[model samples]
Target: MKTLRHITLVVRDYDEALAFYVGKLGFDLVEDSAQPEQDKRWVTIRPPGAGPQATTILLARAATPEQSARVGDQTGGRVAFFLSTDDFDRDHAHFTAAGVTWVRPPVDQPYGRVAVFADLYGNLWDLIGPVPGGACVG
Candidate 1:
């Protein structure tokens, strides 16, 4: 079976994105190596506690005007990502304390508790937590 490996996320600057994702969101920096041929860094990050084969985000610096324009609105003003956490309260508190911008407060859904928040670049994300005795909300 095939598995999705990496999702490229366009950003204005790599370091700034790293600062928000790693410093604030507590994601793990899987790699940061120089790709001299292209004058770019091959940077990858993943959520904490993710498995080795889990999908990782590739922080890609915008190299063109068109790509730059899409830096924040990757999904055209809609939510761009969904982050799943086992502990909703813990992660929600951590994100709030880290100064993450909350778009909507946590609310209980039929499947789980979910909240919307924006990333450093204004990309919307849903922070989801599993319901009791159930998996994460779809």
Candidate 2:
């Protein structure tokens, strides 16, 4: 079986990224190890409750101008991430309370409820929840 395991995000600072993702977004820190061979750290995070069966966010700290330029425009200023939650209202409230910056208000679509928000580094993301009686939809 094949699986897509990780999605990489170019970050400016490791600690800041960790605080945003783990502290604010509530992701779980799965790994944090030193890679002395490359002067880098191996860090990975996943959504809460995902455990070992979810795709991870691999935080790659930019080390060059080219990578730094892509930090917040990974998808050319379009939405670069999608964060789906089981409980729309709860997560929405939590995110709002945490001061997450929303670009659009929540709306109910045929597939689900969605809202656009910008992450700490200004990368756009869709915060989504499943339809009331429907399956998960992106």
Candidate 3:
């Protein structure tokens, strides 16, 4: 069976994307400046206390028009990074205070309370907190 390694997101600017992911969202800078010849910086980020082996989201640089267009179009859709949180309300408040643009306020779903927000590169993210009495089965 094929195993999932990472999810790559093509962004127009690296600095802007890095700022949003690292500065605002609190994702640590795992790998930066891996390949200089390819102009590729393999950045991997995850939530705090998340294990090292946790799946990583890569903020990739858009080198072609087609790539840029694809990422841009995906921004407004359902594609999002699902984040885990213990307190949805606190996370929502933090995002609001950080001046992050929220697509929707926090709402309780069957599985969890989720709040959708946009990154600096317009990528959508679903910040989720599991609901009480809602069992999560791996």
Candidate 4:
């Protein structure tokens, strides 16, 4: 069976994307490489303490005009990314103060307290905290 690995989001500008992911959202930068010879630049970020096996997301933009149009539309369209957090309230407050827009405030659900927010590029994200009896151990 094939397993899912990394996911990359094409952005219009790398620096802006980096600022949103790192400066605002607090994801740690794992790699940043620009290979002109290869006509490609690579960059990735993840939450702190995420191990090597943790999925890494790449911040990239389309290279060609056709690709740019597609990515631009994708950015404005609805897309969701879920992230787990121990302190949902604190993080939600922090992000709110940082000018991040939230579609909904943190709400208590059966699974957890979930709060949704939009990234700089308009991508949606669900910041979740697990409820007490929500553990699954088989």
Best-matching candidate per TM-score:
1
**Candidate 1 to truth, TM:** 0.95
How would you encode candidate 2's per-residue C-alpha lDDT over 1-138 as one tens digit per residue? Answer: 999999899999889999998999899999999998998898899989986988999999999999999998999989988888888879889989998999999988887899998989999999889877875574
Per-residue C-alpha lDDT of model 3 across residues 43-127, encoded as one tens digit per residue: 7777766778777778778888888886645645774677788777777788888888998877778778877887786767788
**All predictions: root-mean-square deviation over Cα?**
1.3, 1.2, 2.3, 3.0
The 10-residue segment of model 4 with minimum total lDDT is 129-138
Please say which candidate is ahead in lDDT: 1 or 2: 1
Best by lDDT: 1
Model 3 lDDT vs. the true structure? 0.75
Give the Å error, residue 116, model 4: 1.0
Q: Regarding lDDT, does 2 or 4 come out ahead?
A: 2
lDDT of 4 at 105: 77
What is the per-residue lDDT of model 1 for residues 19-138, given as tens digits with 9 covering 90 to 100? Answer: 999999999999999999999999999999997898999999999999999999999989999999999889999999999999999988887899999999999999999866767864
In model 1, pairs of residues that clash are: none
> Model 4: residues >4 Å from true position, as ranges?
1-3, 72-79, 131-138
* lDDT (Cα atoms) of all candidates against the true structure: 0.94, 0.90, 0.75, 0.78
TM-score of each: 0.95, 0.95, 0.85, 0.83
